[model samples]
Target: MKMLINVPETVVSDALRGLAAAHPDLTVDVEHQVIVRRDAPVAGKVGLVSGGGSGHEPLHGGFVGPGMLDAACPGAVFTSPVPDQMARAAAAVDSGKGVLFIVKNYTGDVLNFNMAAEMAEDEGIQVASVLVNDDVAVTDSLYTAGRRGTGATLFVEKIAGAAADEGAPLERVEALARRVNESSRSFGVALSACTTPSKGSPTFDLPPGELELGIGIHGEPGRERRAMMTSREIADFAVNAVLEDLEPTGPVLVLVNGMGATPQLELYGFNAEVQRVLGERGVTAARTLVGNYVTSLDMAGCSVTLCQADDELMRLWDAPVQTPGLRWGR
Candidate 1:
């Protein structure tokens, strides 16, 4: 349960400082808790903004760059950022073309971003919003009313960011973001609970030889916990859960995401089983991404997200992106 931070009180601030030092292309405002791409307010392009709790590294913050988020507001660990943070981010990134807020389905995130959108509009900066509720695991969770946002947050950000980078207007960018979210579904399985910096202990009770299926990113209680299963078994259950909900007829973009602490070796192996299951189900994978994208703090598990893709979505997914966490074709 030991954490590396000097103290729990400054965990978020300390991480921000380190992130600032590590990535010069991002304008990291440690005090205000806003991370923005250095080249923000790109002329004639719709701005993209997203954010959430601090536990998930390389998410909203790490994704600020070309073909992704223009600005991100990092909140306290497992907490939502204030409206001022999002409003400031919106103002900083909004060019004449307006901004789109990509919000996850957590109640706090939804409410705060909604308020921020109003605040931005009050300042004469047009703003649109897309809510992501792609988690097929649960209808309601500890932090959300509907399905909690998980892996597909990455999908929405990447595809919508590509569209925005291509000079799509606010309405189009917003529409594309919503479409990506609607087209994606996710299922997470946790082998172990994550320890928050403040708690210095596991967030939930997950005994040895047990695993939680459909776990939320914050270690929220999931569908069920049972004796630990093999990667192939877990993959079968996770992939089937998504397919049942997604019912995707066309090829899909697959994301085999680690829950922070799962090693790449295990994730890649899990991805193979996931691909096997999809193939058996007659589902084609247009593209497959492995490793951690959206994650819990240090949980030992993985999530599978499937985004039913059309030619346009696939093209956008293939677009060049230069972000700290996800980079390709740049």
Candidate 2:
């Protein structure tokens, strides 16, 4: 498979350079592998930080700005960033108020961020953390001991970041982040396998006319593979999978996310079916966001994430955010 990267070894650095050039408001340290907001260490504000493997674009890195993450540390493609990187990010963003680390549930990420949290605390910077494990698709995977963190990572970051930006203390921000995680669930389906730059080929063998349900972002094995299904069929399966576990008492915030390679047109069509499913199940979509947010590298698929939203969650979700990937009401 052909990729735009100059070489596998420098793919992460090269992308970081480009991201730095594209977003001058962000301080991208390519060598140290940290991306931080230009106006970091906001006085009296709890800092927000999140990160993961490089393949998922516009996630941890693209989200560093005024109303998202204060800092992000990117690892290699589909690899976890080291504890030093996270520690550096925490140091960069931490105001006197404290910093909050938004961690996904993957084992490597969990371990590294936990170590980083301890390191930050030793440095006299009070810290709290929220572990996002909203992927209801699987309780255990190769990368995680519990449910894999996927699309809901975005929700946690946005909502918690909004709270932090409002000068909320570390404790409140951490609680909000954890509440968002607990109120959300996600399920993904893969139409084609992703290709990592290092491998330069499909990560898995997904035969044509077939699809894998419950796929992880790094192309981990999913629940099962079966013959390809239509957009409506896939939406039905994915939405039901999420709703079965979510069981929201009221309205929901829906994210119909493309898994990197899927086009906007297809994602919109799929979102319609997802809405149909929600309506049939007597659920109201308080707000709907579509397009690629949480993603796998060049994977032709999508995921549906549902967050059971109350008035407070909805207010935070609607708050102004000035990030490269997700910007609205700014």
Candidate 3:
């Protein structure tokens, strides 16, 4: 595997150190593998925490800041973070209001976060959780019992985090998070597979002239593989899958996310096609995000996430957010 790294085992640790160095506003607990805002335990606000495997950058870690997550625990590459990391992060960020855990629908993530929630309760910290299972790709995958969580995770964290930042109660935040999941749906198409650091090879194989549809973020087997197709065709396939599941009306939030290796140039093309498809379906994209927010290591592909939006959800989405990965507004 041709990667710029001193050692495979220390890649995650080294990257965490680099992230802390680059963003001083965030604090990295190297010992416990948790990243949180420097000014954590925000007085009366409910804390928000989420985590998963480490390959997807700017996800659980880069999202720690004022209007998003309070803390993020990162695990080894493509592996779930342990419960201790989650418990410590919850303890560090809880400031009386309580803490909410936003977990994806992976088996390991669900189990680990549940254990952490119990541990936090034992320590006198009230906790709530929301599980995101928005990927309409497949009902069950290698790491999950149901649909695997994908791009909608960003929507959940941002919108729900905004509510939490505004001092919404833990139960309310959890409710909003769940609502976002219910309203969102995602579909992915992969032109290539990602190479995990430890394995030092592509997680799966795809012929040069084909792509995998309904792919998971962790490089799990998608629903099917098909011959290479045009951008319009790919966009139609992805957007249609989400539309079939959601059938959203009115304003919606659209995210055209690059898997990893897909260039911004290609992503914009995909975005245009996505907009076209949504327009044809009478769904207007009031808010749109295009680029690499969630990704595999070096996979070349993209995923489309559609969230049915309302006035309240849009207002929260437009709220000020200051985080390493996504920052805008005041």
Candidate 4:
């Protein structure tokens, strides 16, 4: 209900304007609603593109830069971007090395991005895609559209973009991305719900003292709801479930993402608890990241993602990456 905005319909478009102005290195395609790196088609480097709804800030758009994504398509708030936007990004960033599309496992995202791939192919562009379905909370693949690609999408984009930046072949990059997707698992808990700009109210209700488990980023109800508990207890439940599923043999990469509105100070404490639980379970976190990587609009919740890693994967994971959202190796 209490939000800083002039109107709902202009939320996404207006935000895009602000993003472009704030990050001069990223060029906003106002017409198509695509954000491309200021220096796209970096000679022979393969282009990387990821697109999704807008509310997930610093996602597809935040990640448009040198080492990560060449371009990102932003749809209306919580709505998938049309294929036309993606097609423009594909054309603008094609550098003869092909393009890799990192798509999340949402029905609308998959459909729109895949269609854009087709549109790009019509003009003889080589486009490959990897669908990230790493959320393990939703087990019934037959019933649901696989698992919701939550925080794992961040790892996928960074690692895959690094691979492409290294001049790895498109097929190899695609394969590596798939490996990350398969080896990763995620689960979330929500303490409060989010309100969309258009609606001007919470999407769903999570009573003052209740929390939902296995929650998705779209404000979708989780598999289970229960009484609130301490951070340690919540960390135990989330870490235990992910560790149980992966049983990672060696060092694993962990991401504790805040579902918007949870302050970073809290995220650090949350990560500490996550680390403690993993240590108790005899799991080593080779690389630990804690922040708001993927988030619901304004939901007070968090999700933890784990990717079982090998030497090669870890090396690739550590490789240089640059983007508006995630920039390193500067």
Candidate 5:
């Protein structure tokens, strides 16, 4: 148990303090544990709020900015934030228009976020929710809480945020969100495990010459653990799974995401394989983003996200976005 923290309980609070200080444009709801844009309640504009565990940086929190999330609440490391926090977030972000909650498919996340939505509705706030379930991995397995929401969350948030920021109606925003979900698929592999600061040790041990297929963020065991293979082979398996699931005939927005510890060199190497796979299927990668967008803290591996793209999807994707985690041409 070798960790660098003085107190395990203070991890989230301390991190939130630093986050708020670092970004004054966003306000921290200390009581609710949610980070919201300072000028919230933009009249007649749909509000977008999402939340999850704390370990996945730049996810719910780092994404709170222009053309993205309106609010992101933090739970404990890999744990869901409480319903009260979400309720407060919904209430704060809601303008006269409406509110949309983007939740992953995880049981805890769904339950808590839904509870908050229900609570907000009691206050006469119209709330809509879109659950992201993009992982190609089996959900009922023992490793994950359910079909873990992985790479596609980024695309969903970005596109939905763009629509919301554009003052699109709540129905349009929700429709776009579901469109993104229907067209996107994700797959991942793990070479190493993550260490929870509280636990002060790795969550699981992977033998020297093996890998986990369809791994989840909370160190849930993937569908299958097998001997390690070449990056090309691994990419083939992952990309193929997504392709099979999606059966996409057109272009895609490809996201080659490293779990945590996998290096950029490895990511590029894996991308090469993904490129080959895409070429074989007559699928052009219209927009390719490679990095660690969502991670399982310090775990080594990568996930491939295929977002089926059209002209409309591309326009929204290319829209300017500024957030702590992702900023480009804004």
Candidate 6:
């Protein structure tokens, strides 16, 4: 229960305030809990909006900027943002082209975003949605009907956002998003569980010297819990699962994402192993990102995401991006 905060209820709001202070380029709608780029509604470009719970930092919120999300609605810790929050973001960012919602495949996220999209449409805003379901962990989990969405969310947002930033039409951007999801797969392993600030305790319990395979970001039950193994072995397990699911046979985009507490040194070591495994399968990593992009609060572990990239996808991925969380080549 030991956490640095004034009160449990105010954790998300307080953090949003801090986020606004820390990054002036982002405008925080404190009342609505939506974060957007200061220069929103970019004239003719299709807007990109994505959101979810608040615990995972640098996700939807930190990703709001040029070449990424136009707006991001953050909810309470581990809770889906309300439809009003999303509708406000969509309205604020939508230009003449349209707005695309990047929704993860969780039940609450799907439902809330759907309601928001309908609301936006009622106001004469053209809207499209791309659902991310690249987690090969489970077909039906506690929070989703089909496979859960995880690391591939970053890939979808970045690649599709790049296309949108290039003035691509809403339909073309939506199609690119779907292509990213279709070509991507992910698998995660957890050494420890995360503690939501509101709960003030770990979401799940894992005994020392053990790990949970195929874990979800919300601390949901994974495929299995087993004794701890070496980093190479763990990488083998995760990368193999994604490879088997996708059967990718060409250049791929690789992301070795820390679940929060895992150090960068260890993540690089894990990334090496993942690349080694991919090399054995005759797949080359055209672009690789290692570090904490998507996280599960303070949980310790990592997930591997593999996206089979063609020339167009690779080009889009390498496009300049200027966001708080991910920025390069700008």
* Collision count for each candidate, in order: 0, 0, 0, 1, 0, 0
lDDT of 4 by residue, 1-330 (tens): 888888998888888888878888888977679899888878888888899988888787988776678889988887888999988998989998888999988888889898999999998999999998888788543223878888889888888888888888889889989999988999999989989998898888888888999888888778898999889999999998887788888889999999999999998999999999999999899999888878888998899999998998888778777666666673
TM-score of each: 0.99, 0.99, 0.99, 0.97, 0.96, 0.98
lDDT of each: 0.93, 0.93, 0.94, 0.86, 0.88, 0.93
lDDT of 3: 0.94
How big is the RMSD of model 3?
Answer: 0.7
Per-residue lDDT of 1-55 in model 5, one digit per residue for the tens? 5655669898888888888899999998665698999989777789999999988
Query: On residues 139-213, what C-alpha lDDT tens digit does candidate 2 reach at each position?
Result: 999899999999999999999999988888888999999999999999999999999998888989999999999
Clashes of 2: 0
Local distance difference test, candidate 5: 0.88
Local accuracy of candidate 1 as per-residue lDDT tens digits, 1-330: 877879899999999999899999999999999999998889999999999999988788988999999999999999999999999999999998999999989999999999999999999999999999999999998999999998999999999999998999889989999999999999999999999888888989999999999999998989998999999999999999999999998999999999999999999999999999999999999999999888899999999999999999999999999999989883
Candidate 3 backbone overlaps, count = 0
Residue-level lDDT for 49 in candidate 3: 98
**What is the lDDT for 195 in model 4?**
92
Q: Which residue pairs come into collision in candidate 5? A: none
Poorest stretch of ten by lDDT in candidate 5: 139-148
Q: List the residue pairs that clash in candidate 4.
A: 62-325
